[model samples]
Each structure stands twice: as C-alpha cells, then as structure tokens.
Target: DIDRKHIHIVSVRVDETGKKISDSFEKKRSDAIRKELEKKYSLLPAEKQRQPENLPLKRVDYKAGDVKKQVSNVAKVVMKSYRFQSLNEYRAVLSIYGVTVEEVKGEVRGKAYNGLVYSALDRKGEKVGNPFKASLIGKTAGYDALQKRIAFSKQSMKEKAVYNRSRNIISTLLANKPDRKVFEKELAKNGISVLFRENDDKRIYGVTFIDHQEKTVFNGSRLGKEFSANVFHELFNRNGRQDSSGIDYEKQFHINNQDYQPEQESTAEAIAGIFSMEQHGDDYEELAFTNRMKRRKKKRKGFGL
Candidate 1:
C-alpha cells in the first residue's frame, strides 16, 4: 500500500433519505483528503513535521451552549446599536449581521401564526442554531412585543424633540434670569405650560411640563433632574426675592403665531451677510481711488496754468 495507513471497513447502507452510495464515494472522499494532507505537508518546514493537521482527527465539534451564547451575544449587540421600529426592520438589520429569521406559520396553543425562528452561519459557512424562539428571548423580542416597542419609541422620539425645542426657548428667554412672571409668559408664548407640585407648607416639590405643540406631558425628572422644582426656583430668583410657584391659569392659550418665537438663523444667511459686507468694502475702496485720481488731475491742470 503506497499510503501506509490502517483502514477499517464500516457498514454500507442506504442513507436516511433512501440514497445509496457505492464504494467509489468513499474512495473519492479519501483521495480528496489525501491530496489536502499532501499539500499541507509540502507547505510545512522540515523542523515542524509533526503539525496538528497531520493528526488522525482534525475536525472538532462546537458545544451547543457555546453556540447559543454566541447567538445571544450577537442579538444583544444588535439591540444596543439599532432601534428597530418594526419586525421587518429587525429582520433586515439582522440579515446584514449574518443572521436570518423565518416566521413560524401555523396555530400554536390554539392561537394563530405567532412564532419566529432564527438561524446563524458559523465560520465554516455551516448553519448552526440552538434555534432562537421569539418568546424565549424576552418579552421585548416577540412579534407583538416589537409592535409595542415601536409605538413607544415613536412617542419617546417626539417627546425628546419637543424637550430640546422647549429647552432652547427657556435658555434664550432666561439668559438674563428673568422673574417668574416673565418666565411663565415666555413659556406660554412658546405653547408650553409648567405645573408645580406644592407640599402642605405651600412649598414647591416638583415640576412637570405640558407641551401643547407635541401633546405630551413630561415630568421634570423625565427630562432631567436639573429641570426639577428646586432648579426652577434658582432660575426664577431676582435680587434676593424668589417666587417659583406663582402661575395660576385655568386655561392655557396656544401660541398661534410663530412671530413671537425665535429660531436659530441658517448658516447660508450668515455666509451671505459676510460676502455682502466684503462686496460693500470693495466698492468703497474703488470709489476712494477714483476720487483721488480726479483730485490729482485737477492739481496738474492748476500747476500747468
């Protein structure tokens, strides 16, 4: 035998799918492996002839627990990096990350189609799954759970935008630390109302903001603790006199006109102004030079006379 390796005869039978293989399949498989081993040997140096690739067994199996942990780690990374507003969005993003999802269609436990399964590719392009069930991952990872998260995310996004806008207005109006009455007026002008919680001693304990433009109610702590009642009192003080909780209006009016509000000017407008100034300066210099030339000509005429 050219290859001095011991070979054992194993059972030869039809596969589970009723497919039959002859002795040629095993011979071909052996030849392919022999060529691979020879190529690996040719590439190795003489000093390291006993490499692990030359061992009888080369492939190793990955444990099921390790595979599950890898999948869950990928899921956690995706969840942190992206906020998927819908299940389709989640699937699309997951596909980009080498994970594929399939919907389990049919009734389960007397319900309609309400399950999902996922698979991932390993390093060798082999599919591996400790297949992740939707319900098993967590409550926020299921089909209906994603729908609820989408709704909440949309609302939260809207609230954040309104909060930023309101904060900008507050900063602009209170740049000089105006009194409580003026501060309230400025907020009302921007279609925002502030509610203060009072204790039994008529002292303010907390604050909440009601934005008419966004139709959302947010407590001071939700925006941040810095926006709470104590901070408001500090902002509204004037000349050692402070009154934080003084506004009393049954019905709040909407800021119908945008003229009362101020927004940041666009960069294009500022750039145009700069160019305009430079153009005016150049025109003035040219006019001054022309006037000097005229005066020089008149002086030459007088000297010649």
Candidate 2:
C-alpha cells in the first residue's frame, strides 16, 4: 500500500508572461539549463567538488509520492474539469492525459473483487506507477465512487429511461434557484435525493443526486456546471437572504402544478447509501445520524372533519 499523506514538490517553469509553461516545454527548458550546469561543474577541481561527475547528469529516481503527484496533476487538469459518468469515460479521459486505468483483483469485504488501478507511460513507452489503487490517488476517482457516480448509466434499459426523466426533472427544478433544503424536498417528491459532500472545513465541495425510483445515481457536475456545489451554495445563501426579508421564495419558484404523488420515505436510506459510496468508513454513524434527522418530521394530529 502507498502512503498518500506524503507531499512532494514538482519542478515547474514560468514564462516571461508569468504563465506556467507546459510540462513538455518546461522539460526542454530544464534540459538546456542542465547542459549549462554540466559545463560549469566539469571545470571544478576534483578535490573541491562533491563528485567529479555533474549533478545534473546523475540518474534521479522519483519518489512514489512524486509519481502520484505527477499523475494526479494530469488527471485533475484533464479528467476532472468535465463530467464523466463511467469508468470507461474516465479511462478515455485518462488516455488523453497519457495514462491508462486498469482493473485488478482486490479484497473487498473479505472477498476478492475487481478493482481499479492506474498506469502511465514515459516517452519511451516504459510503464510507470505500477498498479496503484485509484483511491490511493484521489477519492472521487476511486473504483467504488466511480461505480456510484455512473450508476445511472449502468441501469437497465427500462430503468435507464426513468433515470433520464429524473435528470430532466432535477435539471428543471435546479434552474428555479431553490435553496438546498427546498431542492432536496422538491427532488425527494420525485424519488430523488441530493447528497452534499463537504471537507474537513465544512465547505461544500461536491454533490451526488440519487433517484431511488430509478435506482440510479449521478454526480451533480454531470448534470451541468450550473448544478455544481458552488451554484447550490449560492442558491442556499440567496434563500437565507430572501427568508429574512419575509419573501416566500418557494412561492416565487416555479414548480409544475400536476399532483405528483410523493414517493415513500427513502431519502434517509438513499443518503446513507451515498455516504457508503463515498467511503466514509469511520464517519458512517455521523453521516447516518445527520441524514436521519434531516428526513425526520414531527407528527401533527388533525381535527376530524
């Protein structure tokens, strides 16, 4: 297993305009600099020098973390900026970054299952970063998470249609600028639930919206840039401001009038499933408690007519 906590520094070059040059461009520049250094180092007295050979000419083995950082930098810039719904889609994107995702055998729940690992090739077509787990590199790129993220696309033919319809419903509802609470409630009526992801700082970073009726899940960014966490936070903040001014934000928001029978109370379970998908192993109880409370409602007795 690789230790993910180690941080590594990467060398980069900036042009005269202060823009970071491409990796290939920077490598060419570094090669030129290396030749100059070698010339100067060769002229030094043998007794006064650390080594007779120039330091730049010495073979350098990059640390494991350094390799991880290199692969991740490419993955982040090329793979993450767009919506990818499946491992195939993810693999395709990785290829563009000069990397490939591979399936390997791994133990899950004490039984062996197919898992994902990654590899990249050098200019000479020599493979590097041998069989590193996707999770070891990043959470969102993990095998389990990718399965959940693209679960909708993997649905059966009939259910996949339902999933697409739910997507349309969610897309329309989000366009109305409903706050987080309102969005969840509204989507839940159609058997969809939104799962918001936060970091240690409690700032929203990502979201997955799951449709229980269709048995499918989708990343919010997969829907559109407007549906990302930042836009969701914006809607939430606007709702708070609107509520303080005594404005009925819900009333102003457009929702179809047709009586859509609300689905059964599956929101809590669905959200919990999302937590499981995210691999929050130690925080399961915490996530379950929070989601349970959010879905719980107080009972009110009604007068007999």
RMSD of each: 28.4, 22.0
**TM-score of candidate 2 on Cα atoms, chains taken together:** 0.33
Q: Highest lDDT, which number?
A: 2
lDDT of each: 0.48, 0.49
Residue-by-residue lDDT tens digits, candidate 1, 36-112: 87788875442354433211211112343454444444444444334444444454334323444556668878987
lDDT of 1: 0.48
CA shift at 78, candidate 1, in angstroms?
35
Candidate 2: where are CA atoms >4 Å away?
Answer: 1-163, 238-305
Highest TM-score, which number? 2
**How much is the lDDT of residue 65 in candidate 1?**
43
Compared with the true structure, what per-residue lDDT tens digits does model 2 show for residues 1-305? 12235355575478889997777776678657766777778754423533322111101123434666556554443333333455544544343234557666768899988667766644222455565677777865666766664553444333335447666887888778665555665665565545565545444555666544443445666656877766765677655631212322233222232221121232222222222122212444346545654555322222321
What alpha-carbon RMSD in Å does predicted model 2 have with respect to the real structure?
22.0
Per-residue error (Å), model 1, residue 224: 3.4
